[model samples]
Target chain A: NAGVTQTPKFHILKIGQSMTLQCTQDMNHNYMYWYRQDPGMGLKLIYYSVGAGITDKGEVPNGYNVSRSTTEDFPLRLELAAPSQTSVYFCASSYGGASTDTQYFGPGTRLTVL
Target chain B: EDQVTQSPEALRLQEGESSSLNCSYTVSGLRGLFWYRQDPGKGPEFLFTLYSAGEEKEKERLKATLTKKESFLHITAPKPEDSATYLCAVQSPGGGSYIPTFGRGTSLIVHP
Candidate 1:
């Protein structure tokens, strides 16, 4: 059923370049999140959305923007990418924001900015 | 500030050996605790969620127990396939916030 899918599995961009990481879920979840994981590090929240048309910043949201124009898609845009932004990006979704609800994650998108 | 920390940044065990991973956290208010397993080049896969202290959950060879300040993931007789990075996260109880704060994961390697 393609639970959650992320596009451009791998990409390399130069400094000052821009790109968008695409994410889509078929579970009709109301909550979506974007996280970046550095090598040997944990996932850090970049941005999230409670529902379509509702977006909010999370920890380490700098230099990133997110849009939730549809129930199934939440894309993360990197504006003026920097070398520090080189990390693996993951997209996740949950049925609701309940404390017990588990999040389903997409494979991941590896981005490198040189 | 909310934060999570995991111990033994890396672990190596022989197949059929058992071990435990630690995840500690400090938050204003605890909403939930989550455990995930991440394979090379893949995203973290959900494993268990504990909402309160004294809660325990089990799946196959793994069992998770939560306390007020920490959680433990016990691996019983792990196999090579179980080698991966184990991550821990905590959700804050701040008003209407669901995003979780994650800790640097513990890397586990099982050798045959």
Candidate 2:
């Protein structure tokens, strides 16, 4: 089963260019999250959604936005991207509460901002 | 703010060697702790979840144990494929959100 899928496995963006990272999951999970992982750093949450149309800012939400129009899809938008935004983006989904369920992650989207 | 700290930024172990990684956290009220393994250029893969203190979970050559202030991931006779960065996260309630804090992670390299 295609548990979780992300688009544009690799991309290169110029400074100030905007792009969206697409994420979809087939697990019918209630919780979905967007995170960025930098070299030698851990994953940092950018935004999350509990269900459709229910989204919230996470630890590092600045310069990023997320929308959950449906349970199977959560997209992350980057406006006026900067070189600091260059990192591997990951999308995760969980079935139950964040504290009680196991989070399954997508392959990842490697973005390079120049 | 919730905080999670993992010990040993990097570790090198010989094949078939046993070792342990530590994940320590401090939060207002912890709901649960999670362990994940992330390979290079890939997202994290869930390993284990510890709900409360004195809990333990095991799979294959890895075992995880939790305590009030920390958690341990013990690897027994590890192989090269087992080499990866291990991340630790903690879930807690704050204000009205259930935000989890993550650690920098421990990078393990197993040599054959």
Q: Identify the candidate with maximal lDDT.
A: 1
**CA lDDT scores, all candidates in order:** 0.92, 0.91
Q: Report the backbone clash tally of model 2.
A: 0
Question: Among all windows of ten consecutive residues in candidate 1 chain B, which has the lowest summed lDDT?
Answer: B92-101
Candidate 1, which segments miss by more than 4 Å at Cα?
Answer: none
Compute the lDDT for candidate 1: 0.92
Candidate 2 wrong stretches, greater than 4 Å? A96-99
Candidate 2 — which pairs collide?
none
iRMSD in angstroms, per model? 1.5, 1.8
| Model 2, position B94: C-alpha lDDT score | 60
Expressed as tens digits, the lDDT of each residue in B1-112 for candidate 1 is 7889998899999999999999999988788899999999898899999988999999999999999999999999999999999999888866567577889999999999
* lDDT, candidate 2, B11-95, per-residue tens: 9999999999999999888888999999887888999989999999999999999999999999999999999999999888865
> What's the CA error at residue B104 for candidate 1, in Å?
1.0
Give residue B111's lDDT in candidate 2 (0 to 100). 100
The superposed Cα distance between candidate 2 and the true structure at residue A98, in angstroms, equals 6.6
